[model samples]
Target: MTEPAFLVLTALVDEPRHGYGVVREVEELSGGRVRLKIGTLYGVLDRLVADGLVELDREEIARGRLRRYYRLTEDGASALEAEAARLAANARSATERLAARSGRAKALGGLA
Candidate 1:
């Protein structure tokens, strides 16, 4: 899954949210690393919905506009969990390699 998709899923893990709510939550969850524009967000939402990762929770009419709420489905939660595990494993590998490299550099420096 793409970063945006993963971030979106993370945002919805707690509860259902409207389009704008998802946008804000995603930005917060990512520590402002992801700021999703409405157009781009809808596109990703559409794909996720089609993939059965998300479902429409409900809709409301507010200020003369439809506010659609979406929630993560069971499959969505499973997919997100899998993705998180994958990312964690990759990060662990990178950190291990870096630690090893740092150890080698320190040993070489002490020898010289």
Candidate 2:
């Protein structure tokens, strides 16, 4: 999955969210790294909806505009979990390798 899709799914993992809510949540989750414009967000939403990864939960008229709320489907949740595990494992491997490299460097420093 793309980073945007993963972040979007994560934003809605805990609860349903409107477009603006999802945008804010994604920004927060990404530490402001991912700033999603409405058009981009809707694009991802449309794809996810078509893929059965997300569904519209409800809609409301707020401020004279229709506000749609969306939630993740079971498949979406499972996919997010799998992606998280994969990222975690990759991070662990990289960290271990870095630590080993740093240890060797430190040991070789005395010889140098």
The local distance difference test score of model 1 is: 0.97
Clashing residue pairs in candidate 1, if any? none
Q: Name model 1 segments beyond 4 Å from true.
A: none
- What TM-scores do the predictions have? 0.96, 0.96
Total clashing pairs in model 2: 0
Deviation from native of the Cα of residue 5 in model 1, angstroms: 0.7
Estimate, for each residue in 34-78, the C-alpha lDDT of model 2 and write its tens digit: 999999999999999999999999999999999999999999999
In candidate 1 the C-alpha lDDT for residue 25 amounts to 99
Q: How close is candidate 2 to the true structure, as a TM-score?
A: 0.96
